[model samples]
Target chain A: MTVHALKRFDNVTELAPQALVPADTSRGLSITAQGLEKSFGDNRVLRGLDFHVPAGQFVAIVGRSGCGKSTLLRLLLNLDQASGGQFWFGERNDAKPDKSAVRVMFQEPRLLPWASVLSNVEVGLGDKRGTPEGRALALDALRNVGLETRRDDWPAVLSGGQKQRVALARALVSNPRVLAFDEPLGALDALTRISMQKLLGQVWVDQGFTAIMVTHDVAEAVTLADRVLIIEEGEIAMDLSVDLPRPRERGSVEVAQLEGRILRELFRNSKAGEDA
Target chain B: MSAPAEKFSNLTQWILPIGILVVWQVLSSIGFIPGRVLPAPTDVILAGWKVLLNGELAKNIWVSFWRALVGFAIGGGIGFALGLANGLSRRSERFLDSTLQMIRNVPHLALIPLVILWFGIDETAKIFLVALGVFFPIYINTQHGIRTVDAQLVEMGQTYGMTRGALFWRVYLPGALPSIFVGLRYALGIMWLTLIVAETIAASSGIGYMAMQAREFLLVDIVVLSILIYALLGKLADSTARLLERLCLGWHPAFQKR
Candidate 1:
């Protein structure tokens, strides 16, 4: 069943460039993982998993808490090493992780309270980038997030949504090939979440980085991701594609149907767990 | 109206001190309190004026000020370096923290007798005492601050591809600074206390030495003046530290009101 789902996903990726809107294919790195396993002592978080994300694709992984979705995200970002299996970025599959090619926005903004919003974004550009050029790039990112006016403000002064926008800017300032988000908008209010969803979709389209997001909000997954993956028991139980057009309506029938299917899969597992 | 309200508040601040001064002056004039036990405020002021005119007050104050400043710098520098070393590396902490913790328990004042015996009532003994007294607060607080820095922010820095040194400068050091300032304010208090004790025990100069010399001759007024000088100096040091905290940690929530 998993292989069948993966084959369908491959078909979608092959059809994506021609069938749907043509995404910017020049800037993203393809991700490939085979039999990726992670264990903490006796407790195995991720049993074994295989997945692939094409360059410039926006994919969302949704699952119940403790299904190792976050653990998988961490492994992808090289924050934790896999116990076994091969993960590749582009063509390189060596043990040495390519940290500079990827950046992440956590559930919280994680902005250094001591730094101004501009300086926080500048941190994304490591020392190799010259100071003046880095500052210009950081400012450009802030402008993209529509927070150029707040460049001098401290993170403490920002609203929850604004802080997340700063986090987004910081993630994008370095022009990373892959952007990983671990529930980046989970803390915002409903209205703010909608607006941020629009902003994230727009930015991902503009920058065209291979975007992977792990979230529990099924509706969010359906609305934003071009591909929705439902992970169950450390495995991809469902790999479905959202073929809807960009700027999707929130309460549209197509979006609601996809959300319902994803939620049913998530709840079915939780119900089974309770019965056990 | 707001200006008057502000003026009223300022007046309220001074009311108690002025009232105490009046009571002291009246008691001294009426002979209700003996002057020998505690000299009158006027007598202290007059003694202070005399010392000031003769340059004794300036010289002694300068000596004590320089001693505290130099001692604090040495002790604070060492404490900050050690804190960074142990905070960043588990190996350094394992090798050094236990021995330092054991030594921290010993009250620095208890070493005065040995210090004097070793250095014999010289500048070395006095400065050593002050440095030893100031060291522990900064060291312990700095280590505590570094350890307590938010782990999520550190992880964020790592994911951004910061080198270890860059992470320390950009994240760990800034995160620990507020706590370091707290240590600094506490250490300033100890700096003055240790200097007073050290100068009293064995010194030819400084405010404590002058006060001791006045006591030998029963010059109660000069002794009272010296006490007032110590109080003023302590207040000055505390205010200076608070000003620095305001300047450096303006982003801190507590300091943001200004």
Candidate 2:
């Protein structure tokens, strides 16, 4: 029975792409948030927040703590319902949340520690097939992240960097329409963080999925994202498109200028909020 | 530095037990105690062999083993049912938890006389006593296991849109397995202990009966041999439980890393 499951799982590569966008559906990417008011009791977190992502866009959200950057991501994922706003997926009507096309990578690796690297990746496949076929697809996903050799190894045995790689493999396995990264590399050390930043950019370029990342780091926003969206007080304060070349350097003049601008906007917002 | 050294290092853990056994055998041989009151190690071995040759010891061992196994099965089944139901369902927990806790406070050994009166000196009373003794530990541990599953893992399952049944099977059961195994091992140990006590009090034929019969006849060697058999059997049950824990929780973080 497990061998049959393995065969079925291996067939994911053969299965027709379920995410084939309709040719006539000109509306490729749209995220509508209107009257998006959220509150934990009396302290309102997000107030009338709104944003949109065009087709195949790389958007990075940068903000200080308690500016509701995380909350905004939660709203976007539909993990938590908005108090008043209607959130849509790919220009779909707000009738219901179609989370089938969305994949989220949390800040924590959140890899099932008991599972092998291959099986963990297969979790993204859902009930698309049985275990073995899912496992084969999982192996393929691991290959994409250069972790094929460690397929049979348990999550506990993997290093932090390797675990995050496994997490990336898991997120990408199902081929979701939008890959939502919730500060996915925030926990890594400085050296590993930069390396992962490069990996993220490469994966984003290869996969060509609409990516939305939430990060506190301005350089990260400037380095990887096509457009940097600075959110302050549950509002988009700055949404600037990065006109820099591929493999943008952190110490480069243009990237530094952009990072400074974003940081200034964040500081100004924080001071104003405090005074209010 | 060499193969012998490596072998010795690997076998070092058994040194204390071996030493204790050797000391015990020497003390018995050197007339450290009277033979009638405390039979020599060799006399105990001779008595064990004599009973084995006569088939008396084997019959008694089998009888006790079967009783304990059956009683363990019944009590473990009921305990698991109650534990899972109460652990998962708030309404069930509210209704059953207080009552089970109240019952758990009553000692199983204390209930032996009442049990004998209620069910008579037949196998039913002995099995009942064993089952009653084994029940609480398994129930408490199983409940603890279910309660201790990571809420984050459950949320992840929910986000994946798993059905309630699927959630129970995949997330809840596997997550609770380590704790449940702990309870299982504890209950298994209790099963043997309770069986011995029950058999000594009322059994017609068993290791306990042999020990009691030998005591009456003043056959110190047979009594000592019977005690050895009991100890060996208890060790076997414990080792089996440990092996099962290793098998079942092979994937757990603590076990996997080790």
Candidate 3:
């Protein structure tokens, strides 16, 4: 069911991971955490959290505000150090993983206002920047986001949705093995959010990167993830696999049922906390 | 906003200055206003022409302009470098920023007496005063600019594997540019103010020195001519700064006219 978008993703030869993924194999990397923990002074954000995400799987972390879902995403991306416990990537678990294999799209577009759309995308190329191949890769990334024509324009001119698309392009340019998002569409309006979700889903299917997103929206969680993980009290409260067909309708019975299950799990814990 | 309205506004801006000149000329012609009190526009223009012919005006203007520029370069340069250092490193800020802030609180002009005593009213004392005068605004603004750069963007840069150098060039510098330009514009104004005071109090030759000599002789026309030159120079410096801001910060929405 989730495989429908795979066909459309194959036509783009330039970004289809040339020899990087060994042709037929997935470029995605699996992530495994063993008793992960983090705390900010007295506030324990991630308390003994444990989960394993397989290669190329789409995982959505859903929870209420202050549930440490965003904190978990940050730890995965190494934006913050874990106070306790160990986590490592698949093959890289045995060796020192290059940090380049992980990338993130923030809730804000975070596009460099001073850089042009193309140059902003090129910034993702890291050391490869300022080279012709890097330029071509950046242009390809822009094309991926349907912003190829706006390569020369400053980021300030683009709309919020368009800016996020450029940011997505920048994240995808380096072909990360694991991509995490921290409520990447939380700021968008309803219509733009829907479109962005669709774009994100399509990109994940095409890129075959291990996709993980932290969001509060239950419907968004069901509509996107292969597996939905609800976080509560700095722990994974519920782990449910979504088996619905491709392009799951937002208001459909099955999707709504899944969303309802996750929502109940989330509210139940919050209710319990309030009672105690 | 329309073409004709913009044109009218432009026209209105020049009308008052020109009108004042005309009214003053008329009053002076009728001898209602004496040349000793305030010279007529014609008298001032003639005085300006005489100085231009003898090259005194050019030499004085050059000296003042050079001093202002040299001071700006030295002060603004140190401000930029130190601000960048303090902004990028907390240790540096802890060590240097307090001392700098303490120095900033003292009025730079108040040091003129001490400066004259130390450098004997030579070019060094004058340049030091101007340099000190312009330093604080640029330093404060530059530090504020770098410090306030969105933390989210810095995090994003780090996750994307941007090296420290890459992050500085691609994110920190560009993000801080608008604020830096604000500093530059503010510093330019102080540059002229400090130069004028420094030159007036002492020195060999400049517009300020010329004005002092004119005052001693009671040459009101020459004094008025010196004032005009100072105004013109100030406007020229401001315009140059604005042009640079426009060029460097074209990406800023405030600067995008088109």
The fraction of correct interface contacts reproduced by each prediction comes to 0.88, 0.21, 0.94
TM-score for chain A, candidates 1 onward in order:
0.88, 0.85, 0.89
TM-score of chain B of 3: 0.93
**Candidate 2 whole-model C-alpha lDDT, 0 to 1:** 0.78
Using TM-score as the yardstick, the better of models 1 and 2 is: 1
- Candidates ranked by DockQ: 3, 1, 2
Query: Which stretches of candidate 1 lie above 4 Å from their native place?
Result: A1-22, A92-99, A128-130, A272-276, B1-19
Question: How far out, in Å, is residue B233 in model 2?
Answer: 1.4
Docking class of 1: medium
Tens-place lDDT digits, model 1, residues A22-82: 2565677888999999999998888888888998888999988888999999998878999
Residue-level lDDT for B172 in candidate 3: 91
Computed on C-alpha atoms, the DockQ of candidate 1 is: 0.75
Q: Which 10-residue span in candidate 2 chain B carries the lowest summed lDDT?
A: B153-162
* TM-score ranking, best first: 3, 1, 2
Indicate the TM-score of model 1: 0.92
Best model number under DockQ: 3
> Every model's Cα RMSD, please?
6.2, 5.8, 4.0
TM per candidate: 0.92, 0.88, 0.93
Candidate 2: misplaced stretches above 4 Å? A1-29, A94-99, A131-133, A269-276, B1-10, B256-258
